[model samples]
Target: MASYDLPRRLVAEAFGTATLVATVVGSGIMATSLTADTGLALLGNTLATGAMLVVLITVLGPVSGAHFNPAVSLVFAMSRSLPKRDFGGYVLAQTVGGVAGTIAAHLMFALPLLEVSTKVRTGGAQWFSEGLATFGLVAVILAGIRFEQKAVPWLVGLYITAAYWFTASTSFANPAVALARSLTDTFSGIRPIDLFGFWLAEISGAVAALLLFTWLLQPGTSSTLSSEAKL
Candidate 1:
């Protein structure tokens, strides 16, 4: 990941985000078309999304850390894992790529290039769910990096698979993703009006997780000293 240049990394971020959003929006459309039962439709959407995450993360993580979500990128930037200078570029790439993904999905399904989502998804419960979902996501990511770097893709994929069922908002925990979803009126879409609430909750939760995990994952002074003594 470190060996890649900034331009290459940015391209990877954009491409990865585009593919992720395409999978999300595309799967939703396919699922809804296949099933009348809401639960069955959601199940189909969830499986495709989770599976795509694993594939994208595994393939692109080495290029750009595969941060398709702005909230995840925010956490990495704050932690200095991703440079602050590149944060804006990352967000821009992700947002643009996400919208492109929505458009691509629409093209595949013979829908309009862009349609404002009308599905209502706002209010206190939904906001809280978004917050909790993002918090858990960031925590899982940081912990995976610390303890099991190779398993991050599966960890994220599985977590989101579970979150889709458990969360009221179906865990649309990424700000970039939320914005992209607003452009499509489909099974996965959230109303454009609801994006702000989701974004606020997601960013807040990500920062909160970063704060707690930074302290929690840090080595204690005593432990450091003891290790040095052994050395």
Candidate 2:
């Protein structure tokens, strides 16, 4: 692993997360303004978010492993890929960056800077969808890192793009992203009251993926996983 200081890595995580959320919120706003068709708006948002993921991960992965999502960071920590001591910093950075991204998108669209979302996304189906979506996301990430390290960016981008449509909650598989989205009353937002279900589901999915992959990829091994194993 190429040595980089913790501060630099944290900065990269923050910057990358901010850009990712901006891409999601900004594109959703743009899509809604341009079309009345729900499917078309979703398609536009999905494409923009996916494209941004590819670019951001490619550019920032070397710096911080590009963990813009808290769920991903937690998975890495549990798998011993991310240092336990640095876990809190990663989560904090991602949370703050996510909020900043929401604010940026709101300012760009001339909307209220901190509107609470009224979009009520709840129910058992929605929770199940979130779990399924996050499960696939973590699964793909771990598998790609282990096998096709060079293609992780593209793999993640494509998986997210597909998951957006397949999942009921539009695949808010990221905890930070989901929390930030609640601050925007836009097409991609989720109600604050519904946050618990989403977070629980996402975390559960990520943990499940981590355990499964650990068993499959390195059965009976206890060595600490390297943070720069592949990313």
User: Per-residue lDDT for 25-137 in model 2, tens only?
Assistant: 99999999999999999999999999999999999999899989999999999878899999999999999999999999999999999889999999999999999999999
Q: Over the stretch 21-105, how does candidate 1's per-residue lDDT look in tens digits?
A: 9999999999999989999999999999999999999999999999999999999998899999999999999999999999999
For model 1 the local lDDT of residue 152 reads: 99
Cα lDDT for residue 101, candidate 2: 96
Alpha-carbon runs more than 4 Å astray in model 2? 219-231
Quote model 1's TM-score. Answer: 0.95
Lowest summed lDDT over 10 consecutive residues: which window, candidate 1? 218-227
Q: What is the lDDT, from 0 to 100, of the residue 147 in candidate 2?
A: 94
Candidate 2 structure, TM-score to reference: 0.93
Question: Which ten-residue region of model 2 has the weakest summed lDDT?
Answer: 221-230
Give lDDT: candidate 1, residue 139.
Answer: 97
Leading candidate by TM-score: 1
